[model samples]
Target: MELTVERGDLTTVAADAIVNAANSSLLGGGGVDGAIHAAAGPRLLAACRELRRTTLPDGLPVGDAVATPGFDLPAPWVIHTVGPNRHAGETDPGLLASCFARSLDVAADLRARTVAFPAVSAGVYGWAADDVARAAVAAVRSWDDENPAALDEVRFVLFNDVLLEAFDAALVAA
Candidate 1:
């Protein structure tokens, strides 16, 4: 599989699937999650509510992932995962890594050829961009190694120069 880091909006990525850095509630909040909900339209929220009413009444736990239609967004699928909250003392790197690994697992199950991801937990969750980059690169590269050619491409769609540099540097270091 090919892995590339690009500076772009996650919602605009035309990959087969995009990962949402969502809150546990999955109802939609600020940053990437809110952007995704807005772009996907109200049907996305309705789907999330249905999920809550049925299988996910307790909310999605950090590091786990679930899929939903992309709705009005560019991609066909959205894999939502809750990132560990640093302020809440959930700073474990394993949890952060699980967010990447589980998202890939979900994408593979969906038979998606390409997937786009944001910097999970690096923003409002307050994880350091550099550390989050390292963990994300490690998790994705490890997954790629274990399941060669499982995905055609994996794009880390960074929002700005700093995030791009962090992920790019991690890829280089790998």
Candidate 2:
């Protein structure tokens, strides 16, 4: 898969699927979560609630992922993953990494050719953006090795310039 760092609106991406960094509840919150909720409209929220009601295993908490319609975004689907909030320390780091892994796993299952992801848990969750950038790239690389052509294009979609730079640097280093 091809990986690139870019600063753009996630709602505008033309990928097959977009990964949303969401809270555990999957109910709307600030940062990227809020942006996605607003752009996807009410239907996305209802869809999330319905999915939550049945799909997820009980007491699983965050660090898991679920897929649903993109609602108002250009993409056909949205894969929502609940990232660690950084309070759980190194264990949280692995949980954060799982968010990326799980999202790509879903993309592979869905036969998605393109997927866009925001820096998971970097903003409101408070993980250093640069560090999370490296973790994200690593997770994608690991998943890509197993899935092969699951995704021809994977974008690290950053909303801000600083995040873009950090992701770019991490990807280049990788």
Candidate 3:
């Protein structure tokens, strides 16, 4: 897979799928999750609600991911994954790493050629930007290596120049 780092709003990306840094509820919350739900319109919420009523009755587990229709967003599919919250005492780096890997697994299963991702757990979840960058890059790269030709592209959509730079460096280091 080709890895690219770009500083922009993930909501506007036109990839095959976009990964949301979601709360376990998958209903909708702040940051990237809220922005995606807003851009994707009410139909997105309806899909999530259906998911809650069915497959994810107890809510999505941290580090795992599920796919839903993107509705109004440019992408056809939205993959939601809950990152472990450090403030809530779920501080395992492996869990954070799994968020990236598992999202790719879900995307590959959906036959997504391109997938966009936010810096999961780096915002209100209290993870340092650089640390999140390292974990994201490492996991994504590892997944690509383990499953060659499974995904055509993976974009890390960052919000600012600082995070963009950090992810770029992490990609290089990986």
Candidate 4:
């Protein structure tokens, strides 16, 4: 697996799959979730509406990710993942790390070599960007060690230069 850090729009990554930092409901909301939905158009919402009330682990709160055509974005599929809420402490870090791990798991299962991730839990969820970057890089590194060929490339798409700097520092330290 290859690791990369970048500042880009998750809605515009031209990869096999892009992960959406979703709410527990899996319904469309603001930040990355809203951007993905808007880019994928109405069909994405229609598809997600069919999957209401999907369940996962108690603390994790992720739903079974559903694939949709990236109607407007460059990616072929969009993967929706619900991360833990803010104020969750180290417990939140665990759950957020799981979000990246599970998203990559799904991508590998689908034979996707490349995937893109937004800064999960850093938007409306209020997770510290630095912490999220550390947890995400750790999770990806661990996952890569276990499944060396599972991912050929992974990009951390930061929306702003500050976040880019944060991820860059974290990656260097990782």
Measured against the true structure, the TM-scores of the candidates, in listed sequence, are 0.99, 0.93, 0.98, 0.89
Best-first order by TM-score: 1, 3, 2, 4
Which portions of model 4 show Cα errors greater than 4 Å?
53-60, 63-66, 87-91
Estimate candidate 2's alpha-carbon lDDT, on a 0 to 1 scale. Answer: 0.85
Which candidate, 1 or 4, would have the higher TM-score against the true structure?
Answer: 1
lDDT order of candidates, top first: 1, 3, 2, 4
Which candidate leads in lDDT? Answer: 1
Candidate 1: residue 171 lDDT (0-100): 93
Query: Per-residue alpha-carbon lDDT of model 1 for 1-70, expressed as tens digits?
Result: 8889999899999999999999999999999999999999999999999988999999999999999999
lDDT of each: 0.96, 0.85, 0.95, 0.80
Ten contiguous residues with the weakest lDDT in model 1: 1-10
**Candidate 2: residue 166 Cα off by (Å):** 0.9
Tens-place lDDT per residue, model 3, 1-174, is: 789999999999999999999999999999999999999999999999999999999999999999999999999999999999999999999999999999999999999999999999998999988999999999998999999999999999999887898898898888
Superposition TM-score, candidate 2 onto the true structure: 0.93
Model 3 gets an lDDT of: 0.95
Give the CA lDDT, 0 to 100, for residue 121 in model 3. 95
lDDT of 2 by residue, 1-174 (tens): 898889998988999999988877787788888999899899999988887688752522567787889988899899999888776553466787899999988887888899999988887777898889989999899888977877899998899988998898888898
